[model samples]
Target chain A: MRFIDARCQLGRRCVIRENEPVTKAEILELMDRCRIERAVAYHAIAKEGDVKAGNMELLKDTEGDSRFLRQWVALPHTFGEFMSVEELLKGMKENSVSSIRMFPKTHGYSLKPYALGKFMDAMAEHKIPVFMTYNELASEDALYAMLTDYPKVNFIISDVSYREERKLFPILEHCPNFHIGTGNYVVHGGVKTMCEYFGAERMIFDTGLPTGSAAAAVSLICFAEISEEEKTLIASGNLERMLSEVEL
Target chain B: MRFFDASCRLGRPAAFGEGMPWQTDEILEIMARCHIDGALAYHIVAREGETQDGNELLLREIAQIPQLQPQWCALPATYDEFLHADALRDAMKENGVRTLRIAPKSFAHSARPYAMKELMGFAAECRVPVFFDYGEAPCDELYEICHDYPDVSFVITNTAYALNRWLGPVLDACGNLYLGTGNYVPHRGLETFCKYYAADRLVFNTNLPTGSATAAVSLVCFADISKEEKELIAHGNIERLLGEVRL
Candidate 1:
């Protein structure tokens, strides 16, 4: 089945070996290998520091490639490093950046609703999707609070494990804008069960590319017990709908 | 791609999930769905209940299915709660047991190299593979056992991520050490592992019913290595190791 990876990264990872940057060609080649039609990617260096520089680099790197959907990193308001929420949204709109990722722990901000009120408000108003991996949301309480407070904001939780359903189900029940990226969600019969309860639209395909195995993720979705229509939703349809709905 | 799953389980999990009965038929069905040809499985009863009863149950469950290889849990030599050295070997031969696993952390047993010296020696002498998974024994102690008993083939199963630092040296030093790729996926990790070490040291495993077998198989199948290397990791290496077992 054709796929559009909702979560991906490029650039030097801080924790791993130095100077091991993955080129756009390599990312595209990996996409071809894994049968991914497109990928939404952020710069890994953005998670380290200087998100502005990282985001700019990500934009520059994917300049000519339409397949590489650009995503910027959102820093805390107190940092005063980037433009105000209004200006940031305007810039993102002009640049065709549809989504943004968060690194709360790295940026030294509490992800409580109050701390991110301004940023979350802008994202909600603009209908921009927010992506948070394990690096951002570490606790269920914090995630619950954020989703509860920002009811309008679309949040995509990527690289989530299947065992986290116990903690995630309660939040999911109440939050309608929440979606899951199936990179690490490899629990046996999890996709089928989740599709049954949550509907297929709430799930999106992701490989956790450049950090995890793309083949593994694709194989998981292909072998899942869900229907072909459900697989199509998770593979690319849901991601395309979310991205297209992004109000410039 | 046919898989000889080195890490799998039968019976219910102790603390996690619903008490779903994971019988032999269910295991075979799951394996078939995932393109797995056979599995080396231990009974959850062996881990939670008495060892002997668990072993007998394991044997009974896999009696008809030759693909489901039974692995018994070994205890310390001092307790004699289970058979030791020669007797253990005799029992293994009689029961068609080719592999053994130990859960030191869960069973409250010491992981010192000397604790299971006799069993390790017997396993090495008999060319049987003794397996350990995450939480069973610390890597350092496992290294010590592998170092002390170079003749014994030691298989480390269900390894966690970000363990390359600890594993690199142990695997480098010990030729007998093999890794079960149940949860070992890092960025281009399988390729790097093949580059640094021999491809034969890596074995295909599912950690099935608990972990995704398809994920494990796809990791090797789509790795950026030669077809021969992929074949070795997929089933050839483990098949060679299993072929050495006398029983």
Candidate 2:
């Protein structure tokens, strides 16, 4: 079965000193080796560098690569460097971007509704899928508040740990629009159990490439005890649908 | 590909009602479905109840299944309800059990060199592989134990990812020390580990019923290492370790 890596990073993360920097070629080579036909990639430079410059670099690096889908990261409109909500949304639509990841903690901003009022409004109106790292959405109370406040925007939790079911289960139960990437969701029988509860449509494959094992994540979904149909949805169907159905 | 799971539990859990309840029959059935050839299992009761009862139950429950190898939990020497070093060794010989596991945190005992000198010495002499969970024995404490007893084959199970820095020195210094793959996913880690250390240091484990057997198996089966290394990790290394048990 083919796979689409919904979560991947380009460039190098400064925090990790041991691993070598991942280039666009290596990411593609890894995809071919692992049988992942496509990927949604974010620039690691954005984690610590200026978000605007990082996103631009990501665009330039992936300019001709159709297999590599672009994932832009942003701070709130509170940070004027990215500009007004309308303009940012317009730019993303022009670029055919389906998703935007947030690094409120790393970039030093707040994801609270008040701080990102216009940004959240734009996301909800366009039905854009917003990805947030575990550090940014650390508290369930805060997550619950954000989900309740913006019901239309699709929230995809990224870089979640394997042992996050205790916290993730409750949020999954409460929010309908909430989705999770499979980068670190390594609970025993987690996929089968989650499919039983919420169905396979709520999950997507994310290898957390460059920082996580692509082979491990891909084979995790492949070896899951769930049905072949559910595996397809998780492997690539759901992500493909989400990307295709993005309301521009 | 066949897998030999090094860390797994059978029967009902004593606490931490997170994982689904499992028994020997259920674990075996799951293994059959997942293509795991065999498993070394410890009973949860041993972890939660007295060591004597847990070991007895483990032996009895796993006796009927040829694919299951029972592991005895090590208790402190001062504890009367549990067997001391010599008696425990005798029991293991009689029961045909070769592997040993410890839960120092749950038993509320320190695994410091001073606390476990006698048992550690016997384990080293027996060439038995003693398994310790990540938190059960702190990295520094384990380093000291491995240093003190180089003859003993100390196996650390369920090490968290991103602990290469902590494990690097330990792996470099201790040839007798081994790591199980129950929770040892570290991003191209298998290859990187093989690059730094020999492939024989890794043993196949799933920490099953508590962890995903499929996830654990898939990590090794899909790793970019050679077929020989994969074979070694899958079952050969663990098979060799278990074969050295005299009893």
Candidate 3:
């Protein structure tokens, strides 16, 4: 089966938990063992206070590789690091950065429209999808403002808490452009609800590896008892569309 | 090269995230994909509040199986349903339910030393081992129970959480405690579990058809240790433990 790991924190294994290190090479080899065809990995560099540098390192590792392409997780908040969209676009073309990840809560920026409006405009102009991290709808108007402004730019919401799941649907209904990524959560009945509500089309498989595993994500999708075809979509097809829509 | 999927959950598979049904054929296929020899599956049927119904169904299914050894779940709240001691023994023993699970959290009962002692004495007298549900932060009483009765063995799932805070203490308290490689916290913490304790105390578990076979295999492959240790934790230890249970 061809599988793509849609999300990861470290490029290589580096104690994603406390002391469990998994290098990038180790990750690929493990994916190979799991029959995974391709995987999209990132540096949890935002947590390090150097988002672009982290993404640059991520791009550097995947520069020559055809199988493992790069997905840049940028902190729009970390704009002092980059002065121009030209450099950002150049990085995307040269380094193959497919998506930009936003951490409104993690970075402590108001995900409110007034705070993110100009940022989303910048992201839309560059034509990169903004992957939102662990969300709380408390900032709904601000988040939706970006969605309406950059409806073309994919808004992928993530870290959907496994406990309070019903909130995702209404939030999803309002933000038509938002897709969900199930990261490191193990609450009961979360995935079943996602497959049931989103029809597996909007739901993409992500294991939050190092913190979790690609096999965990895939097995979760597979164990949902959704048809194998639905599993294919959750594991691969939805991600393919995300990249395809971004014209990557 | 056999597997004992000590982390099997019998309810709807999607409840845990894996969408596959918890049926036997699905399990056999999963074990096959990962080169698993065999699995000892446990069912989680508390959604309808009938943990025993889940056990009965599992026992009926694995009655004659040489591969699938049903690790039965023990819900003390259901004691009244058992009615008599012999009837309870038949329910546990007749259809191949050897290992009994102590899911205190699921039962919503804070574990007590005496409660576990009484229950474990029952299981041990019946010649069955007690395997606790795979949780990291087991209540104070559960530990008390283990310390009180060393003869009873345990299969601790989610050892990552358990080890994070109490690695040294947990290992110190129960030498007989074994780990089930389900969805534990740090994927490779088993290395520490085996290193601190003995590899003999660790078990090869997938929580399969539900837990990631590939991920479980990955932890075995990527863990920073020797092939000897890996062999023991991945296969040998579980085999030895199951053998002790006369499986």
Candidate 4:
């Protein structure tokens, strides 16, 4: 099955271990090994250093690279530190970027509608899906609040370990736009159970590459006990549909 | 490509997610589906509290199932709470059991030599491999235990992605320390690990009934390593470890 990784980071960041893949060539080689057709990649600097410079680094690093789909890290435009909502949308359109990632916990921003109302509103209008890891939220309750606050914006949370089933289930039941990245959801039969309860459309395939395991991520979907059609949807179908809906 | 899972749990957990495959039959089915040929399983009853009964319970539960091998939970034998060295060895030998699992934090005992000397000494003499979750020993305690019982092969299981910084140093200092590749999900984790430490140190595991067998198997199979290294991780290394048990 063709897989499109919905969560990946490009460019160098701080704290790289001895043999961990750090360069774009290494990341692409790993992706190729796992048969990932494309990855929705943001900049590591955007996450760890400066958002604006990191976003630009992502574009430059992934230039002429069809294997990576551009995803820019977004920050609230408070104090004029970042681009306005209109400018952000215009840049996304011009650059052919289709998705946006947020690091509220790392970037020190609030997810309340007060902080992200206009930005999220534009995302909803453009059908641009928002991506973040589970660590970005203060709690599952906060995640629920943000999802309900901007119900139209699709949010895909990645690296949610196997421990949050009871907490995440209620949110999944209530929130239609909250999708899970099936990269490290290593709960035994978790993919099957999630499909059974919420359907396969709610899961988007992501590897969290250069840090997350692309081999294990693809294996989770490929060997899941769900039906072939459900596997297809999670592997690439849902993400393809989500990106295709981007008005930008 | 046969996999012998080094870390698996039997019996129902105190708390579990909806539709989690905790039953023995369900675990076996999942193992079969994942092409896992055998497993070294510890029982939750023993791990939660009842050390003696839980160890015995593990035997009965997997008595008929050849695919499930018994991995007994060990305590320090304070106040005669568990089997002494001789009795434990006799019991393990009688049952064809080749390994032991410890939980210092859950059992509320120090992993230092004062508490674990006797049990760890038996493990060293018998060449029996000892297993535990990373939470039980953690960072410094993990290093101390490996140093404390250098002869005993120690396998740390159920490790998530955030432990590379802490775990790397311990692996560097301790030759006895082995890693259970159940949920070690760092990108290029296996490849990186094999580069610094050879593939012999990575024992294949599913952490099944809680950890994903599919993800664990795929991590080994699809890792960017040689076929020989993959064989060593998939079953060869674990087989060697179990084979070395003189019990």
Candidate 5:
């Protein structure tokens, strides 16, 4: 089945291990091998170095590459250091970017309504999904708060390890907009269980590529004990629908 | 593409997700579904605490099941609280148990030679491969244990991503250290590991009941490595290690 990676990092980042896929060519080769038709990619510089510069770097790196759907790393515009909501939306439309990723913990911003009320409001208005790793939030409590606070906004949290099922289940029960990125959710029979409880629509297939395992990510869906319909939705359909819904 | 899971836990966990496969039948169903040929399973009772009792429980649980091999949890035999080296060896030999697992941190013991010399020495002498989670002997402790028991094959499992930086140096320094590729999900993790360390040091495991067998097997099957290398990682390396067990 065709796959679309929901989370991927383009461009080089610090702490690259020996023989890891770094360049666009290497990443594309892997995506092809894994049958990933396209990847929603954000810039590594945006995550690790400079947010604005890295988002721009993502555009340059993925320029003319149809295989990459652009995703920009967003920062809260405190003191006008970053783009205002209007400017951000305008830039996203101009660039054909559909999704936004944030690093509230990494960027040292508050997820409180007071801190991101306007920005999240704009995201909710545009139907643009926001992405982050499970670690980017301080706790499951913070994650619950964020998801409940922005009930209309879609949030796809990735890299949630096997240990947090108890903590995450209640939140998944309460929050319909909280989707999980199936990159490194390596809990045994986890996908099947999630589908059983939360339904297939709640999962968005992702290979935290260039850093996370593409083979493992795709295999998780491919070998899951769930139905073909569930697999199809998780493999690409859910993410495709989410991206297509972005008004920006 | 045959798989012999190098690390799988048996019995119920203290806490588990809904519908997690923990019983022998449930585990067997998953193993069959995933096309796994066999598994080396340690009981949760043994791993959680009661090393000797858990070891005995493992023997009883897998007595009729030929696909599941017993992997006993070991301790330092402190104050005769556990089995000494000789009795442990005899018991393992009689029961056809070839592998051993330890959790120094959980058992509240130092991994140093002063505490682990007798147990590790038995493992070294018999070529019985020792298993432990990365959390049991993490980072510097991982290196120290490998260095201390250079003769024994040390397979570290449940190593999530973010360990390559710390693990790379250990793999370089210790030839006896083997990696359990259960959840070592770094991008191109197996491919990169093979590039640097060779596939012989990489062992395929599922950390089953908790770790995903589907993900583990898929990681090896779809890895961008040679068929020969994949074969070595999938079962050949682990089979070789188990075959060398003198016990």
Candidate 6:
């Protein structure tokens, strides 16, 4: 089964399995071993606490890789896109990069709807998919309300733990643009439950390995009691749709 | 091979993770996959929200499934338990059980050490190991209780995430305390846990259904350790320490 991971981390802190840097080849090789086809890669910890620096590092490694769709990290709000949002978008176009991811917990920023209001506006205007780190369901509701109103924008949240996800049940039945990464740890019959609640279309297979969760998520994906269609949707289809949207 | 699972739950709620109740079928499947010969399962969280009755519900299940050995739930700070430790002792003896499990979070060791002490004294006399679930337990006095009673054995769950700078002192001070691999999430020191704590002192457990059984077992069974150490931690050491002939 082809798997498109929504959560794959970059840099050398807890990303490596045995205290070594993760080479892209080794990563893809493992993906093949685990049956993951492609993934959107992000920087680890948002770079020296400077998200722009993190974006640079993320872009640096994944820029030329065909298997990965590089998710950029920046809030041109503070880092002020090297020129303007237009110039930044143009540069990302030139670099063949696709989306922007925000790490509120690790980035030390407030993702309260009011906080991300303007950033959400700018991304919506440009048709950019905003990747959010796992905050909480209550907060996700606030973000989801805004993004759902803006039909052009899609937001993906990753790193949610098992408990934080239970709070999502009420809202998951309603919202569609919001995608959650399975790096959320064990949700009990996590993969099974997610497939039941939302078709595998929204689910993304990720290995927040070494630091995130056990390297067991891939196995969970393999073992989840769901159809091949749902597995393909989680493993690759949704990410393909997102990557195709940000075509260079 | 006598199997005693210091950590096992039957009706693992969804909030804990995504799964239906770990009915006997699920347990048997996990047993086949992980090669857990037998388990002394405890229902960690009770839907009824009452400790003794929740224990009763679990015990009732154990009664039906003769393959499962019931280790009664021991949530301290119960006024009834405070008054009736003798009755509790008698009940356990009648059941032919060797251990009583307690979630330290339920007892709040920092706020009430006296109650914890009383419970410890009672368990020591009963000759049953008291299991404590220690995920983000945030307790210092609980360690003090373990230090105070060298003869009493306490099972500390979630040791994988329990380390901080304070770990060195905690490890040095804890004697009768043993470790359980209860964290569903993997940690950095897990492979080292078996070696540093020694296989003799740790039990192979998964806060199953909530946590991945395959993940926890894979970490220990395939760790960069010897086969003897693996077998010892896998089933032998827990058997020796608990002294129960697991069915």
Give the worst 10-residue stretch by lDDT in candidate 5 chain B: B161-170
For model 2 the TM-score comes to 0.51
- By DockQ thresholds, what CAPRI class is model 4? incorrect
Q: Lowest-lDDT window of 10 residues in candidate 4 chain A?
A: A107-116
Q: After superposition, how far is residue B19 of candidate 5 from its true place, in Å?
A: 1.2
Residue-by-residue lDDT tens digits, candidate 2, A1-248? 97988888898677664654367787788889999998888888766787888888888888878888888887754313465678777778777677899875555444544356678888887777888867686477777778888888888887777787888788889899888888788888888899999999989999988878888898889899999999999999988887776776
Q: Per-residue lDDT tens digits of candidate 6, residues B1-247? A: 2234557777655464455436767876886677666777776444225567667777777786765677776655555642367677777767766777765555543424555666667777655777766643534444565767777777776554424322333454576777776562335454555545666777777766666776777767656777877777677766776673221
For model 1, give the RMSD to the true fold.
19.5
Model 4 segments more than 4 A misplaced: A1-248
Candidate 6 local lDDT, A1-248, one digit each (tens): 66667777666654345644366666666667666666777777454455667667777787667777777776534222223566667867877767877654443333433234555666776667877666633365655564566546677767777886656766566677767777755777887877776777777667664355425767677778988787777777777777676633
Relative to the real complex, the DockQ score for model 5 comes to 0.01
Off by over 4 Å in 5: A1-248
lDDT per residue as tens, model 1, A109-175: 4554434667788888778899988546758887887788899999999888868889888888899
Off by over 4 Å in 6: A1-248, B1-4, B12-17, B44-48, B81-83, B107-112, B139-142, B161-164, B184-191, B244-247
Report the number of backbone clashes for model 4.
0
Q: Against the hidden reference, what TM-scores do the models get?
A: 0.51, 0.51, 0.46, 0.53, 0.53, 0.46
Q: How many backbone collisions does model 5 have? A: 1
**Residue-level lDDT tens digits of model 5 in B131-191:** 9999998765787889888999999999987666567657766899999999999888888
- Candidate number achieving the greatest lDDT relative to the actual structure: 5
**Model 3 per-residue lDDT tens digits across residues B1-247:** 3444555554454355546646677767777777777666666563235667777767667666567777766655444753244565766555656677767766765555544445656655665667775452353334555667677777776554433333344445567566676666464566666666666776767766546777787777777878888788777866665556632
True contacts kept of each: 0.00, 0.00, 0.00, 0.00, 0.00, 0.00
Candidate 3: residue B175 lDDT (0-100): 70
lDDT of 4 by residue, A1-248 (tens): 89999998887779987788988889988988999999999998999998999989988998898889999999877545589899999999988899999997777556655457778999999999999999998889989989999999999999999999999999999999999999889999999999999999999999888888899999999899999999999999999999999997
Predictions: Cα RMSD each: 19.5, 19.9, 19.6, 19.7, 19.6, 18.5
Q: How close is candidate 6 to the true structure, as a TM-score?
A: 0.46
